[model samples]
Target: MNRIYLPLAASLVLIVSLALVEGKMRDRWGTPGVEAAELGKRFDQVPKKIGDWVGEDLPVEEVTRKTAGAVNYVSRLYTNSKNRNTVNLWLIIGHSRDVCRHTPTVCYPSQGFRQTGDPLKHHIDVLGEEPAEFFTATFSKEDPSGRHLERVFWAWNHPNTDIWEAPDNARVHYGLSRALYKLYFVGNVLNDENTIDSSASVDFAKLMLPALNAALFPEKIADTVQSDIQPAGDAPAEEVPAE
Candidate 1:
């Protein structure tokens, strides 16, 4: 009887864990800012093209904050984090307690960073919908040392749907997401904060451009073979000049 009950209890524990994860993902549909319900409307529209979305730019406070290896260019009143190594991960880019100022009420949507360890969990932060000027404002590495500088673009959209389940364009957008994820992993290996020139991100942008542009992207993991990326011996640090 005791042995049988142990198995039943273990199964129940697994079920509970899965349920919590599922619930968290469901909670974060799009970027979370102020405009939650309104953003949901446009986000659910089934995107046509990248340009079709992220149209223009509205007024934001333009705040900057530094973390251990990452810096967030965000609005002052609209961001927070509880990760130990997160450093100061959110840069506030807006004033008046809002990330999006044009709306004067709703918050601008900002998306990215699925629940820490859960890549599938997407959190939606929104401001407004129509007359919405969405621009890809990227943040550069605030600290140069011990960081692999990489740029991250943000916008508010529902995270409920899996980009893997979306159309080709979704994969394209996800390609960028994957690129960012890779940079993060590599940054950890190199023990450096990833930084990029705001205007010159297009250079590193090519890192994942192929997949983003490809209609049928490869499902396999890239660079499976360990080749030249590894260092042979202890040598001088590789100094990469600005692109």
Candidate 2:
């Protein structure tokens, strides 16, 4: 009888302890870390034109913003003047890495797009910066009119570095960070071979990543510029203010 009671008592104690810990974590995560109103200038900093691609602001639904807990975000359609290739770029910034919870792997399927295969991880190298990790996938869907294919590329900028990373690594590194950003590029049109063409998405990323770095990590940009200034004649550029 004593032995039976001892194991039961231990189990009860362990359950209560685990419950208490879970409650504390929930409370900590519930605290408001970043507010959307505080990032009012995020949209203004993103340029309308990068290289030859012209961007037009695209509206984001309020319900979607609330669902993602976005501090600030931009949805834009960028079209290349030369090739007429188009990519929809969506950038979401949130106070917590939880923002990455709604990645294309989850969202596209819910929106009726069937994923073609497993997402492939690629080290995307921008022209002027070190390569960053991203996940790319091709999704296909059919509508009343016809079938469509979209190539989706996504990454999250963790708190430790400006380079974007896979969602798993982003969660491990930035799970409790004060701020994080997610970038997505969706290429809508398939090529003649009926495959999603990623040239447009790749080209747009190469052109836009530098500008994104400036907007997202202005402090780091300032530091780099100051360090690179020549002692003879050049002066440090004015610092880009942040919230």
Q: For every model shown, what is its TM-score relative to the native structure? A: 0.19, 0.77
Error of 2 at 166 (Å): 1.2
Runs off by more than 4 Å, candidate 2: 1-31, 35-40, 167-170, 192-198, 230-243
Give the per-residue lDDT digits (tens) of candidate 2, residues 114-134.
Answer: 999999887767766788778
Shift of residue 35 alpha carbon in model 2, Å: 6.8
Residue 9, model 1: lDDT of: 100
| lDDT by residue (tens digit), candidate 1, 1-243 | 999999999999999988775554333433433333232232222212232112122233324122111112212111112221211112221111122222201111232212122112112222221221122322223243633433333232222321222121322343212011111101111134343222222222222223221221222223323343566675677999999
- RMSD (Cα, Å) for all candidates, in order, is 21.5, 8.5
How does residue 73 of candidate 1 score in lDDT? 28
Worst 10 residues of 2 by lDDT: 189-198
